[model samples]
Target chain A: MINRTTTAALAAAVAAAALMSSGANAQTANADKERCYGISMAGKNDCAATGNNSCAGQSKADYDAKAWKYVAKGSCATMEVTLKDGKKRMGTLAPM
Target chain B: MPAQPDGNGLTDLQHRFAHAVLQAPLAVPSGIRHDVRPTRERRFGVYRNNVKASLAAALAARFPVVARLVGDEFFTAMALVFIERHPPHSPVLAEYGAAFANFLEGFDPAADLPYLPDIARLEWSHHVAFHSADASAADIGRLAELPPEALGSVRLGLHPAMAVIASPWPIVSVWATNTHDATPEAPAAGWTGETALVTRPHLDVLVQRLPPGTDRLVAKLAQGIALGAAAEAVSRAHDSFDLATALSTLFGAGAITTLSQGSSS
Candidate 1:
């Protein structure tokens, strides 16, 4: 059951949290960062471009896995992975 | 089979059209005719391509990190198979891909990376939080006004846009490095797990790596557990659980939307 100490602790935590949040708000208020768009890699744009051919699928890849090979070009390629069996190896998107 | 007009002719036509669009595989629907240079077969292929491409684009937007993890070609191929199996039920493209993580779990080609599905789940949570309805944060001043005796029964209403994900993989780190421009060093060796908090407090959505044991406490609170009881339960289970830090994290994220003093007795 909660008693005086627990309640006091709660009060203190809430007060501290409030103070920290206000500071965070102030920091963000002056932040120079703004969201940018349209700079993503080919075919990875956040929204599709609407045009006369808007509904047409422009994707070069299809459902056949044999037609494509893992390129290991993304950031995931650089990461090191420790598998479930305790063996460590460099990460690749290719099927093992 | 070509669908013939029945009492519900429009519905049947729509069904056939959808089936042709998604499931014709390599063949064009026999019902279509083309008078232009492009044959009916070619025109149908274009239409089919457009449907899959646009939907794949939609999934790419939602799961950019996943796209980056595997290259574009593989991601598109995988997405096509997924799209054929799980087309969007709603017109809102944003609502699509709810089952993407589940699909990735059983996806054979990506089976080598066990953490891929968790990453998809993390991305989906971010997408949901980004689109959730906005609500004003609970006024901290009012919380301060409550008497100390009332603290035990404090019930917190979490923001509608808040979600917590606990994964045995370093999902947060992987998501961050892949999504952001400044590539930080990859997650270090011997890393065990990470718990991520996705919240949209105001204009932008925030994804934070939560402290250890904080997710447990937050999960309890999310279930409508009273603050004191939730804290006590988590503390009993996690030796390192800190009530103060947990409360601070929740409040800082504007995750607590309403606070009420329940019956103290």
Candidate 2:
């Protein structure tokens, strides 16, 4: 018969395995995410589809406001910025 | 003595290529030539220029705020020196510039900006946060579900992208003013110490200035200390430690990722 301590350890192990699987699922879900505009730093954009440049690291200004990096869908609005006017704004889904 | 290839070994070839990238174009490794031309010095020069430009661009990309503070010309010169000394060990360019902050501290030219190194440190933290793996924020409401006696043993885990940067200068203000303002104004008077929290809760990386004792508390919690012990440590150091406000800030910013009981038992 399994001891009480061993049973407790088994339950903990199962819980940990569940947590790890959930974390892995989240990573896979975010893998195919696309770039969200207004969050990329200068020359740090993943890629621009507007034909501006063929590769990453080409943006000419800080927070170019138009360039973006691939982020999970529904997360574009979560990239918040404090504007020059001291107003907070969320990153746009498309080039701005 | 003329440099000779070590019996055409791959290791030797890689060493020579590494040297070629770090040093002058004239020393471009032998037996390595352009695809179209055979060991053309001009073609090698083109490659050298591109490599240097791209590396410099990477530095600029990683440390834009630092670049703005030092101005373009000076920043480029400094970046060249840093690139020569500490060439990237990793293929990921985003992982570059880890030594930049420390380099600035020892750089004689940047002695005037005593705060420059700290600013670089802050920027590096921001860079790291931006690329760090994502994690779901902890559910603060779960704490209430725990029995009061078991609460003391709960260990908190920080988000994968969270970091605390403690500096003697008002680094958060300095970073904020320079980043948000088109024409950055002078630093505010009554400047004192600052402790900043860098976190990427969702898609955005946020840099927030922590209150007096929060950094200590967060640091302790991050070390896997249980709730009671971490709070007691903070209380001993700072009698005014506000647990409510600090917890609110931590949860609001999504800095805490996991909460597990019996870890410290």
Candidate 3:
């Protein structure tokens, strides 16, 4: 059961937190920053499609369900994965 | 399709165009035509490719760690499949990818890395926190002034941008490692569950790993539980739980937005 002691303790904790937050705000008050919508494009190839709509032809994805070829050959390759069933496995995608 | 007088023509045309563009092999909408040329297939093909590529690129930007986890080729191919299956519902690109984590759960290629879906979920949460509406911190001085007994009924409101994610995988560590200058590495062998606190107290989004039982505490507070009762409930389950530290963490992150008195539960 909650008692007077618990209530007092929580109030004290929250009060201390307010002081710490004010300190942080003061420090960041002078920092220059701007908020903007939309993220930057990822790479040169993203814009490499040259022609008006023809650039869309430059898209690399085959989009074929049956003849898939890409493999998950990223950082997961370095790590060994432990499965839920206590079986260990390499973090590699099966080649399609 | 010929234009109908009922004004459903535009909507019908847009649906066909969207369907054609999103489809593989460039299925041009039948009625499309270019002013100077007899056929618009080449021009239409460009539209199809741009739509797929740009959307895939947007997905890459939002989920960079996911892209890094699986190399570029794999990510692009997987993203294409995802985009085709789940096209954008809103004009805003940032709102896309809410279904990506679930998609990854069923993706056959990523079956080996079972943790990928959670990582995607983590990244999406961070994205949401970054874009969430901002609000000023609530006046906490009143809490100190309230009578000690009344403190149990005080309900502290958390920031709208704050979210707590409890996961069975070491999502925070994997996300942290790939976020900065460090080269991507394997997660530690003694993999344990992790809970993350995503918040945007000010301008920048922050993702902090929370200690055990803190997630339950935050989740309770988010549900409008009063301070004293929330603490009591959390303590019953988490022997290591400290009320002061949990409150301090929330404050330090600038996550406290409002405070009010409510019937103690």
Candidate 4:
């Protein structure tokens, strides 16, 4: 089950812009100034931490922000969810 | 009511109610489920809270400027109302907010800013096009090999993800003031015409405010007219249509390819 933290909820709203890094997944020059989150698979929408606070979708961003807040405060929980499809087969959200 | 069953897990009725809460804003009355928190604020299930959070986030994503315009609290409430009416059909959350601009138009609360709907649309278009498929400049060498005289006759192809929209309301300007990094200017005085181009070239998605004749020219070309004919059509309407500048721009932006010089059929 997704814990759904409030901090993540807020950050998710803020994470609406420029989620895509450049054409290549390379978080080259623009990394320090801007957050460049990476996705290992474009097909599955998986992303890596670019250290930038901004993520793309509000729900995912909010969830991530809440998780990171704990990291900022030196205490974050390992939040997880098993996504269930029509057959009810579930899978966990891989860590970013 | 008969003894409301406890919810260590969910029953059929509980599942149905939980799904509704998962999808929209609703008063989820409780007697069954409970929260694990020590304070124990039980509004029903985690499902309800998750639904609101996700939907609110979707609204914020779609209308960042609108959220900024109204401030976060007002926008959250607005989004809640929106989510109640329109839960997403597809799992693609990015495409979920398509109806927001229209909803805001009829939304009694936002009646004062009559142009809000159009502005929302412009923003939504930007949002959608921002994530659309965009490819780098194709082998321009193919076109480079074509003869100069043949340039106009060769049917140009637009970039895969380029799109355009024209609004009677000055939406591009409104969106810029609300979202861009440039020096802010007062909103465009009146709802004079405005046109926008949404295209992803290479990696960045660009939403450009087109010049006066640019809309007509792009619109004509979007209808698949050859380059010469589209340019001629715009030049006929506006004497100052600069064929050289426009062609260069569309090509560079990946909005046009294979410059067609052929006669309009």
**TM-score: which candidate is best?**
1
- For each candidate, give its TM-score against the true structure: 0.75, 0.72, 0.72, 0.61
Off by over 4 Å in 2: A1-58, A61-96, B1-11, B32-42, B186-189, B263-265
Best by lDDT: 2
Chain B TM, cand. 1 = 0.89
**Model 3 misplaced regions, further than 4 Å:** A8-96, B1-7, B34-39, B139-147, B185-190
Candidate 3 residue pairs that clash: A53-B46
Model 1, position B198, has a per-residue lDDT of 82
lDDT (tens digit, per residue) of candidate 3 on B1-265: 7677757766788889988888766467766665656447778878888999999988887787788789789999999999988988898987999999999999999898888999999889988987899988555555556777777887888898988878899887787666531255666645888777788887666676776787888888888998888888898899988775676566656667888888776
lDDT of 2 by residue, A9-89 (tens): 333433343444344332221234656777766665655546455334567665556677666667778988776567777
CAPRI-style class, candidate 3 = incorrect
List model 1 lDDT by residue over B166-192, tens digit each: 999988778766755334457754467
Model 1 CA lDDT for position A14: 67
Winning model by DockQ: 1
Give the per-residue lDDT digits (tens) of candidate 2, residues B73-157.
Answer: 8999999889878878888887889999999999999899888999999889988998899999875556545645555677888
- Please tell me what DockQ candidate 4 reaches: 0.03
How far does residue A27 in candidate 2 sit from its true spot (Å)?
28
Task: TM-score for candidate 3, please give it.
Answer: 0.72
Model 4, B37-79: lDDT tens digits are 5333454546667877877876776676677667788888888
